[model samples]
Target: MNNHLSKTIKNEMFSHHYQLLYNLNDFKPFGVEILFRSSLFSNPQRAFQKAKELNKLYELETTSISKAITDIHLNSIQGQIPDHLFINVYPSTLIHDDFVKTMKNLIEQTSISASNIVFEINEEELITDHYSLHNAASNLKEEGFHIAVDDFGKGYGSIQTVIEIEPSYIKMDKFFADEIEYSTHKQEMLKSMVTYCEKIKSNIVLEGIETPEQFFKARELGIKLGQGFLLARPCPLEDL
Candidate 1:
């Protein structure tokens, strides 16, 4: 990272950015994925990686959640709350004792419906303890909050985790979406995953779809929900 980027990340100059997930069948807004962005960085992923390196991932995740809830509350005042709000959380963060308590308190304080909040667990990190992960997921589900296994195929124990945690949604990884128009193998793989999701009765969301061809392919594969530059790009809450 450049010097300015380093400073910006350290100072936490990030703002909550949102990308709209659309229902492919009708092209209607289904939910908004909460993302963090900064002027110094093109995307939030780099800054998040830096935070993880510095052991500040938990702090950053909590702060982002608080801000996102605040944004949702503000939007609710204007009758602008979408069907759902998708918030990303690491498995490590979910396993922490304080995570669930803090989240519940925030939801209470903000007066946001727990049912409308979908916690999309980022599956990129290693899950050392499946039992703890399942317990945490169960607690959130018991509270009526939805759970989603994000980046499904790209992560460790993707299938086993889904079977153990039983998320309401399974997000197809972008790797399968990229250049899918030309690859027959990828198309077949996506079709198989869609079948599995159907068997499990879990909804699927295709991520990183940046082209019309990719979007159409996803629809052909029977994916109902999707997020990508072709559909909508990340923007400030005010822009929505």
Candidate 2:
């Protein structure tokens, strides 16, 4: 993968999950997107330790912070609660049969409706074989989970992955939002992507909308949903 940033700058990725809401005002509130950490592992030994600990607790094929999400959901079921949950899946692990089976069981046991679930795919890493990754995505789609291509326009496989996966949602990165104020080039790129997405039936969600100007700009571009500090920060489940 090409390092898009300077080597002097340290990059850190912390995985956190958030729910996606369609219509921003819908009662039933029908859609969700699970965000994942995009930065690569910093320490080999510590990463291994984290993975081993996660593997012991969850049925995921790999041990990583993402497993923490599955563990929480697997143990979250109790008396009456909402029947919706979205989880992240790394592109590298999407083809693991056991992991997928474990996910199916977790959703089933919790009685979570599949329609409200979304599998967010982070494209920071290049997918050498689009066919395999597309197949894995298609399998999850077959089971009724909405697909979302995360960090769109900020990764190596942005356009190709969008073409192949054909996710239900395309999340715009903060890079675009920050540049839209001064760059006609960025605005044109964004508008073209939105147009293509519409032609293919994909909804656009602008991530990292931090100011009123940003929000209105996205709205002007026909973006239906906007997420970021401007709208609402990620709150705890109880708070949400």
Candidate 3:
């Protein structure tokens, strides 16, 4: 799988797709979360897991990110950009020693401002070094890249991470979006979260919204941003 994955990345067999994000206020194209897809794997997560096992996760991650940024920059220059680019990133990769240097080089080569990129921090892994992660995240912010925390309350150091990093966006886990319209408790919970996010000026985005009912409910509750199949799926950039 690693060899196959290497070939895919090396040959650019993989493509970057956009998952459209909408402003629930008026359903306009707010931005896109850039996603990677390849015919070699029906599930990209499996490939990422394999990369981690092989200790080539950094190579795999940085290579794809560099490609995505370069492509998005050129596309934007050619009138292909609809809005900002949100790219998913791993915490470990972000804190790695070479991370900042690699990113700076990309920015220099592409001439794309950090403001144009939002690095969504994937909190799926257990955080072993909060201090290192915090310093790295802070440095990214200093470099002008917006930081978003993914799976906000469903991971280790959920609250501590939020307080430490103070992400520019808080992406609520899909568990809260599951039939939330039917649960008063869930509604109240979301409302509380919404309030807190608002207070801190960190935009709150609801993920996995697949129905009009959930969409409208989220909007009614003051959610300003959302993403899911109902709005759009991961597809080739040209499709957008």
Candidate 4:
């Protein structure tokens, strides 16, 4: 499966984007997010059905997410990027020993530094089994790749996963970023979350900063790391 993803990602059709590091304040921490230009499975219904059938067979295949990450890493290395690159990964891949082994091997073979690579564990698919996640995170952390809990506030309506995993970075949902201007409640909530993040030595990144107002609001609230159309849009590595 890993081999399959590797081959598919090498296809020239796909392009990768690296999340930029914007400082919240000089004292604020910096970080990045990796996003795909398109959905991993373009056809959701078909993909789900195929995934279900694959599950019935209990077979492991390299996920599109993993392939995309690998692609981003290679791009970064070729471009000589120094910032950490975030890559989204599927839960099934996280639980697969073969995938883990392949990832470790790939890291060794690649020019990208393990410490500058981030694996983004999306909450929608991450909550199924507790033990598998724990072991997967532990294994990845031990290998020097940081973990980020993507879209933290919007999914599953709880912070149980965040508390449990204590990932290296937490990405605020677009909702929070949108609401930071009008609601004191939202502002306070973000402040508390940022405070908690500070205690754990993790950085908080405000996503969807598409406007000047959003950028100012995030900075005023101490969110140094940001992403949106205002600062810079995702581009080919060659452009950077």
Highest lDDT model number: 1
lDDT of 2 by residue, 25-122 (tens): 33243443444433454543333235434442132223333343454454456432334344555576676556566557656754455665666675
- Give the count of colliding residue pairs in each prediction: 0, 0, 0, 2
| Highest-scoring model, TM-score | 3
* Clash tally for model 4: 2
lDDT for every model? 0.86, 0.60, 0.84, 0.66
Pairs clashing within candidate 4: 23-224, 24-224
Indicate the worst ten consecutive residues by lDDT in candidate 1: 1-10
The runs of at least 3 residues in candidate 4 whose Cα sits more than 4 Å from the true structure, single-residue gaps closed, are 1-13, 26-32, 38-79
Q: Which of 1 and 3 is the better model by TM-score? A: 3
Candidate with the larger TM-score of 3 and 4: 3
* TM-score result, candidate 4: 0.79
**What pairs collide in candidate 1?**
none
Q: Write the per-residue lDDT of candidate 4 for residues 1-240, one digit (tens) a residue.
A: 444333434552334565566775662324445555434556433343354454621131244445555665676666655467776655655677675677777777666667977777756563677677778888888988788877878766337767777788888887887857877987898888879999999888887777777777788887768776676676655554
Per-model TM-score on C-alpha atoms: 0.90, 0.72, 0.94, 0.79
C-alpha RMSD values across all candidates: 2.9, 7.7, 1.5, 4.4
Give me the overall lDDT of model 2. Answer: 0.60
Scanning candidate 2 in windows of ten residues, the lowest lDDT window is: 1-10
Candidate 3 residue spans exceeding 4 A from truth: none
